[model samples]
Target: MDEHESGAAASGASGRLARYVVAATLVRSADGGAVVAIVLLAHASGQPDWASGLLGASITAPHLLGPFIARRLDTARDGRKIIAASALIHGTFLGVAGLMLPVTWAVVPALLLILSGMFGPMLTGGVSSRLPSIVGRSQKSQRRAQSWDVASYGISGTLGPAAVAWIAATSSPLVATLALATAAIAGAGAVLALPRQSPLHDPGTVPSPAHTLGSIWRFGPLRRTLGLTVIVAFSVAVLPIYAVAVAPSLGDAALAGTLVAGYGVGSLTGSAVLMAWPLRGDSDKLTSVLAAVVAAALLLVIATPNFTTALLAFGAAGIANSLFFAATLAARSEYAPLETRGQVFIWVGALKIAAGSAGTAVAGTLISGASWLPVAIVAALSAAAATVCLIQRSKGRT
Candidate 1:
């Protein structure tokens, strides 16, 4: 082909890749928004603290199941089909459950928890596995893909709560749930548009799911990456509860909402900053220090008695979280084998879910006793653990 024709073809391919990346990102954004809406709906329905706990549990409990399911399904006849099917089923079920049941019904919360948990790994693993296919195998390409995913989530985190507030105010909280369901449907559509099987997975070679996951665990780099993810999750767990704690003190629910919005704003800023100028360094060292910084920020929130200080602290925490997420994912992808990328990614998702659940549950119980010190202590410990893990990994590498 002539030079012009070749250039035109290359440009066309780039455009297609960009579209896929954008679509994947939008899907994730909608999912994040939907999750926030579900939590808000549970609260609005006057579910007791136990019920709310269950709602949170339900959303996260899926992480435990993620590794097992991804292991089995990753070797299935069609990984993409499995992902698309899961998304469609999750969306439909969630929508119907939200529409039919009142907030007080225990069944609704249970169903939401189950659906969300099941959907979490399927969606996350599917997306991460597919990334290498849409973008090239180069580090730069992978970083771009990861950045797109993080950026979408950052935007969703900001908009999701606002959308929930607006919908909950004007109409029923069910409206918000329905909106999330719509996003799930769109996400499924995006998955369907993808090639039948991810190029990351070889059609000719099938490894035992157990072996696949086991290999990921054996890889020092992946293990360190997962360890950092756990710490990130623990630090993040503080944000939701912190927002709730600060709400009553502000004398307005809207202020609490604004606090979260501020965090979202900071998250967006952080992600943008990362994308504009990505981090390049020793992944283990970089992630450990970032986790420590985030932990320190959380401590500031706990130490400060004033609402203004708390707000600033929370905003800074959000920015730290955004950077940590981008950096962590980039590190994970780099260390993972392409064939088993989905399994590794799912494992990270599972670790994060477990950590967040544990952190939130513990933090909630502690804060109930009117003490924020315990919250800070837990965050500090988690960050410390993450740092130690990374340091050890660095040492081993040397």
Candidate 2:
């Protein structure tokens, strides 16, 4: 290629990356804000705790049918347009919910909340499935893009809650809810600004859902990676317990918050570092190695008597968490059938949510009987088992 053409290509790639980052950040930030806002709004309106749970359910319940929604996107001529439209509608519903929650009948607000949540699967699944197309097919480029995507989640997770708390405290929870609703609409505008692209597949020949799902089951690598992902998700469910566990040991309770926050900071830092130093060898191997390292860290958290030692270990585990996600995502992109790519992404996401829920439940039971150490031990053992399975599977594949 000519030097001028190469320069133009680089510029275009950078521009696209910037645009995608902005759009992703907006959507994720809104998600973070909405979670806190929903609960706060329910409480401020004199609704019961169950009402807050209902609000959360309205959002998460959509993931059960996420694969179908993702399938619809794969078959659409312009998934980007679908994403923009959904974001707009979602924002409208949230706006109505915000308005109704403060004054109108509770039923109306509840319905509006449910309606708003119906579009979440489309927004998240569409964005993730489209990353390959947006970033191009190069492995190194894909790794960087996926890392950035994970980093975006961490950033939004941090900022979103803070924004909600600040806004609700200074203003009103309803105002905070409405503000996040506006952020959703802004996210739609950002989606609209994304460069146009061809559909994921020919709409005429888009694989049936059954075929796509069957294909996922048949692909050994995809199957195992997904299984491992669920295990990882389950293992991380008790991460919040770490803060409680660390407080007594440290003699300074505030150190517990710092230790917990270190995980996110480490994840963000790891995303950047992994972007530059891409993992070598098989992606599954990378995943297994990461899982093992994370397992070791969790064990340290369980065994360490010193606060500093446990804190550093927690940070290392956090970095592994991010790296494992990047590796697994890259593996999915590489191995998933083109016709079923969207389904795979949606399925993985749903599975992670379910697995995390299960993990949390199990940890709660264990912690009630004993303490945080038992929960950490359970999580670590689960991860170690997954690592062993991956290593054995890799060996068999060889």
Candidate 3:
């Protein structure tokens, strides 16, 4: 291509990148906010805590079926179209949820919301798989792309709940639910804006979802990456407890929220660093080092007596967690075969959600019985397990 054509191409890709970031951030922020809003709405309607729990489960439980949905997406003519359709349908469900007021149509709303879960994986995994297309084969460009994606996802996870709380407090929980429905539609519009591309999978080579799952189960590097991801997910899940332990010494329990917020900020910083100086190393080695750092950071948090030290440690842990997340994604994208990429990304996401759920339950239980010390030990053990997996990957055992 001539200089002018090359310049134009670069400009076009840059614009698309910006759009991708905005759409992803909005969709994820809405997801985070909507999850909390669902529980809040359920409670406001006089439902028990179990009912709230059920509502939360309706959203995440569909992740288990992600491989199946991803397999279908892989076989479709236009992945973007599928993703857009799913987002639109999900938005419709969220709108129906907003209308199910007065608490009488609770069961109907729950089922509709549960069905909505089916589209989430498709939307997220589809976007992720398209990253390679957007950034091309250059390692630095790809790293920047992934970092942008990771940073946006992490930030959204933090901001989404806060947004929900603000909207619910300032207005009403019903309005917050309705807002998520609107956000979902907006995300659909973003997906529709992308330029058309061919399918990511070969039609004849596509396997059953069961076969895809089995392949991922047996693949060594992918397995190790998933294991490391679980560790990172669990580490994040325990942040609230970490905040609780540190906030009292700072003269206000509210200060503990800063610890949680610090982690989010740290993730943004890490992503920025990666974008500026992309890592061109083995993801296995990177995962191992980052996991060890996170473990040490958690241990430090447990030992630090002052709130300042604890806050710093948590922030460091968050930075390492973000880098670790990027490494895991790189490992999968580097090694996962073309036909199985969608399924792998889908399963990885599912496992992370499951790990986060487990971490929350474990952290809550352990902290109740033994405080943050035992929780730290549990977190350290998870990190250690991830380290072992990374080591195995390095040894060519994966």
Candidate 4:
């Protein structure tokens, strides 16, 4: 390629990455806030605490099929459009739920949320799996992009809950729900401005779901990456618990949202630090170390004497979680075969989301026992999973 062509290509990639980051944050913030908005709405409506978690679960549980849906996108001419459409559809459900939650049966909104969640992949893995094509083939460029992408989740995580909580505190839960839902529509518009692209398949060369799963199982390091992904995500479900059980008992209910936002703020801080001085190592190995760090930080939260200390602990854990996420993403990409790569991202991401849902359900039940019980169990499980991943790494799995 000519020097001119290389320059133009780099410029284009830079531009695309910028737009992708902005749009992703908008979409993710809406999706992330859905948990808080729904929980608060349910609680405000006088539903049981378990019902609040179940409602969040309703939207997230459908993430199980994301990997297969990813294959469908792999065959599509342009996935961004589909992803944008998904955001719009999901936002619509949240909006409708907001409007109807006051007068309609809770079941009606629950059903809407379930359908909305079926499209959840677009929010997480769908856009992420496309980073390679967007950022070009350079490993450095891709790593940088991954940090930026993870940072979006961090920003969204902090913004989503804080936004909803502020609005709920000042206005009402219904208004917060509607406001958050608009992010999806805005994200759809941002996605359409990007360049057109071909499908991942060559018309008829798509792999089967079984083939994709086989690839993941065959790679020891990749399998470990996925396992740690689940454990981290499950522990992260403490978001709702902070809102419903822990923070409120300590003080105001708004503190629950504030605590959740602290984690996100920590995520943002960690990702920023990584981006400035990017890590260089076996990503698979990095993942295990980061996972252990995350678990340790969570345990620290349990020992904090008060809300201020708990927030700091949560932020520390958030930073660790963001770093772990980047390592896992890199490991999965490096270890998985190219053909099934898209499926791998969505599949792993689906499990991550599903695990979080399971955590919410379990946390709700355990909240009645002791507020610290859920955090304790989650931290222990994450620590165990991190150790297992490290052992596999030592076995020369990478």
Q: Cα lDDT of all candidates, in order?
A: 0.69, 0.74, 0.75, 0.81
Off by over 4 Å in 3: none
Task: Put down candidate 4 lDDT per residue, 1-398, tens digits, no spaces.
Answer: 99999899889888998998888898888888888899898888887888788887787777786666677666677777778788898899888977876777778888988877877777887777767767766678878888988888778877888899999999998889999889888888987776665565573576776777777877788788888898888987875684467776667777887787787788899899878866668888898888888889888988887789988988898888888899887877677666666778888888898888778878888888778888889888888988988887788764
TM-score of 3: 0.93
Name the candidate that leads on lDDT.
4
lDDT of 2 by residue, 1-398 (tens): 89999888878877887788788777767765676888899899888888787876676565565666667767777778878877887778887888887687777877777777767665665667777877767777877788787777777777777788899999999888888888888989998888766765457667776677677766767777777888887887677665665577678877877887777777887878876787656776676667666676667666667777777777877887888888777777788777667778777777776677677767766765556665567556767666676767767752
Runs off by more than 4 Å, candidate 1 = 1-14, 34-56, 76-78, 103-105, 108-116, 195-213, 246-254, 303-309, 368-372
Q: Rank by lDDT, highest first.
A: 4, 3, 2, 1
lDDT of 3 by residue, 314-340 (tens): 787778778888887787788777876
Residue 51 Cα positional deviation in candidate 4, in Å, after optimal superposition: 5.6
How many clashes in each structure? 0, 0, 0, 0
Clashes in model 2: which pairs? none
Q: Model 2, residue 126: displacement in angstroms?
A: 2.2
Best by TM-score: 3
Whole-model alpha-carbon lDDT for candidate 2: 0.74
Each prediction's TM-score versus the true structure = 0.84, 0.91, 0.93, 0.86
Task: State how far residue 307 of model 3 sits from its true place (Å).
Answer: 1.5
* Lowest summed lDDT window (length 10), candidate 4: 195-204
Total colliding residue pairs, candidate 3: 0
Clashes by residue pair, model 4: none
